[model samples]
Target: MRRRKLSPEERDLWSRVAATTQAIHPVRPAPPDDLPAPQSTPKQKPPPPKPDLRDFRIGQSAPGFVLRQDLAPPLSERLAAGPVRMDRKAHQKMTRGRLEPEGRIDLHGMTLAQAHPELIRFILNAQSAGKRLVLVITGKGKRGLDEGPIPQRQGALRHQVPHWLHLPPLAAAVLQVTPAHQKHGGSGAYYVYMRRNR
Candidate 1:
């Protein structure tokens, strides 16, 4: 306990009382070369390179994969954008196959629980047998084994038989579903048109 060395007039009176007090730990002044040097919030663009899947395997085939857009819009362009409901000159001769399906119903190999009760018993017996233009084939769909990650729109009865001919037990015996002309089965058949059994 022997410390005592300050005599130069007490080291100029302790450097004038430590430059008039104040420095609980302050030595940080070195940033004046014309300001502006603290901007670090622009590094968030490194998240778009995750499609390598380590030499990817599951059913390969993505070499130049280019789909550019299609999360739905080809069930024959959603049944040719609906809204024709029937009889515009017999729906233009049943979509140009020149009207002639007085009842067809193939539904391919069934299985949406046997094609929704055989398409609600063939559109309620083709509108109680008064048919007007049946057809309803549903084929174009076999590309299977996609292995998930969403992308399966091939033909579960060509998109659920035009959504079970518009639900409610065949939307009251249909009356106009369209999409069938390429000689009656283009986007895989579907010219329902029935309602008329009063």
Candidate 2:
């Protein structure tokens, strides 16, 4: 088939149309300068401070603490005298029987090596006896006392008691264990709560 070619005038007309289209569609300029810039609002103030915990006092109603003594038979049977020497005011505060728990136990005279087995037995026996809590006292070891001039190889019973509490037999019987309060035996004692025996 034969084709027809555009004359010069026709070509010139097409070019003019393309140029006119581009000019009409010139890129829109950024929004007019009359619009204001965005300003952020100020931050709100924080709420007032909470009460200081240091100012709070432990109430007489705080749970009673016990000292576990390791003394043998007759000596072990008696409850250890309260280690804390309370002032007259403090003593009066305890007159209401507010600081006593259900029971107490003492482990003071026994070494860890000896006491470990007794501790296991006590937990089991305490559970069977329907006792919920017991106290175990492990004295702050022979720190200043005479021993080899250099620190001896002897272990600290105070530190060893906690380790025994974490052992399998004792841990299984114990539901929870915590350090005794000051009026009890303080850091030298622990309060052991036993799981109910099935």
Candidate 3:
């Protein structure tokens, strides 16, 4: 391919750039090659001097990296503003139990220690089985508690189950964790979104 020569305007612009680059930083003399080597008890080199603010003139080429804004696409073309790619409406549908769950696990009557491992197993299996939305029944906690210094939380599993879903072992397989619809288990249950096994 034949290379195109710069227009007169471009030549003038580059000439100005070259002139300013040289003017801002006068050339420094190099140390002589025959200079004696430093002693074993080496003196610490002084820190580099601060930049001369005047040398930071606009349009001066920087030492390392520069983002080429001129080459970038227009804002409208780059952004393509619209609804986010994530289908939030569909996610809402799943959370509302409008979509049928692929699997269900009832964790009622189980202690927290027992329920934690069971929850992990259920999610892992569901993901491997290619299940997306699964219902976990945690049972709505008791309302009234005996008055004490520290009142116990109502629902153990309901609160703790969500935390377990975010843990490393289960976080990979799970996506969104939302309360189940009235039909599934309502506040007592949750709809666990699982990632597809690849």
Tens digit of per-residue lDDT, candidate 1, span 91-192: 887788887888788878777888789888878987897877788787887866655667766667788878878889788878778788887768887888
State the displacement of the C-alpha of residue 176, model 1, in Å, after optimal TM-score superposition. Answer: 5.9
How accurate locally, in lDDT, is each candidate?
0.79, 0.61, 0.75
Steric clash pairs (candidate 3): none
Ranking by TM-score: 3, 2, 1
Best by lDDT: 1
Off by over 4 Å in 1: 1-73, 76-78, 81-87, 90-111, 131-150, 154-158, 162-176, 179-191, 195-198
Rank order (by lDDT, best first): 1, 3, 2
Count clashing residue pairs per candidate.
0, 11, 0
How high a TM-score does candidate 3 get? Answer: 0.54
Candidate topping TM-score: 3
Ten-residue region with minimum lDDT total, candidate 1: 64-73
Candidate 2 local lDDT, 113-198, one digit each (tens) = 78888777777788888876677777655644433334332236766676677688776777655566667776666666567777
Each prediction's TM-score versus the true structure: 0.26, 0.43, 0.54
RMSD values for the candidates in order, in angstroms, are: 16.7, 18.0, 24.7
lDDT of 1 at 108: 89
lDDT for model 3 comes to 0.75
Per-residue lDDT for 58-78 in model 3, tens only?
888656532333354432233
Q: How displaced is residue 111 in candidate 3, in Å?
A: 0.4
In model 1, pairs of residues that clash are none
